[model samples]
Target: MDEFLEKVFEAAFKRESEQDENIVRSLPFFVAALGLVLAIFSQVVVRMPPVGTIASAFLYVLFGSATAIFSNILWCLFQLVRARDFKLPPNEERLLEWADSLQKFHKTGKRTRKAAEELAIVDVRRRLVEAYAEAAVDNRKSNRHKFKYRAQGFMGLVLLMVLASASVGVIFFDKTWRISHGQGATAEAAFPPPHREKRIDRTVRDGEAQASGAGSAD
Candidate 1:
């Protein structure tokens, strides 16, 4: 019975380990893709038209979200590195010792084992299995956390992409509107003409000349 249980535990552990390995292997590719997208979006933002306060605030939010997602990805990578080195519980060593003794005794064909010894072996095996099951549970919890972080990061990336795309659309739209309606000429018209300033200066000089003539005549 103990052997069967041990085999089951081993199989489950192997499956989990393989799943974790696959996740770790795929993370680098995901991180690289996200980073590339972020870089492209950053360039787009740089080329975007000047925005008002509201749009600038939105851009700041997008920047912060992207930075947080990048940080989360980095943290997940670090966690994967740490999780690769799994450590057994301290009591597991004693359980292994007991199992070894039982195996040796059986191999020697010893038929005079005490009832207490047999019970102790059974208890140790049960405890060992329990310990492994607990460890597996912990591993599963960690995996869930990894998934959650990745999901959040991806969501943030998507949001940033959407915001950047919208900003780009606005820029193109504004440019088109300005061109279609001759807004550029209107903007030029908004400024006072240079000739007006020259005329004002000429009027001031004429007034000063008239004043000087009157004083000379007096």
Candidate 2:
């Protein structure tokens, strides 16, 4: 009985320890990924022009994505803290004492195992198993939460990329429009209209006739 209980406790402890280690290792990756996303977002914002109606719509979407990413990052941080502080049942000391007693009994062979002590040990083992089971469930839940947040963060990143691309396209389109309009204005400035040219010719003829008449009179 003691051997079996010890095996169970060892297995449970190993499993929980591995889970903690995994969570600790994964936290840095999450933080790094989020930081990269934020940096890319900031670069995109810096290059963005003043927002018009269409651009405003894109900005709103980008804002929502940013909010989601940050929220997920906070959640991941909270989970990381919780994982770091994970512990076994509070009666762990009592269980360890029972295990020690059982060990000592097997070694000395001087005293017979009391029925009450055996029952108590059995109860402790059962509680430990239950605690381990609960911990396993919690670990699984935490993993699912991590996966969900990661997916959301990636989705936000995709949305940000789309927003950036759309903004660039709009900027290019506006620049082209301005260039075309400027070229049209320049062409008009370089060439006078037909009506203006005709008016100028008529004024010159009148002035020449007036000058000739004045000279004849003199």
Q: TM-scores of all models?
A: 0.57, 0.50
- Tell me the deviation in Å of residue 96 in model 1: 7.7
Clashes of 1: 0
Question: How much lDDT does candidate 2 score?
Answer: 0.62
The clash count of every prediction, one per candidate, is 0, 0
Off by over 4 Å in 2: 1-5, 83-85, 89-218
Candidate 1 Cα misplacement greater than 4 A, ranges:
51-85, 88-131, 184-218
Judged by whole-model lDDT over C-alpha atoms, candidate 1 comes out at 0.64
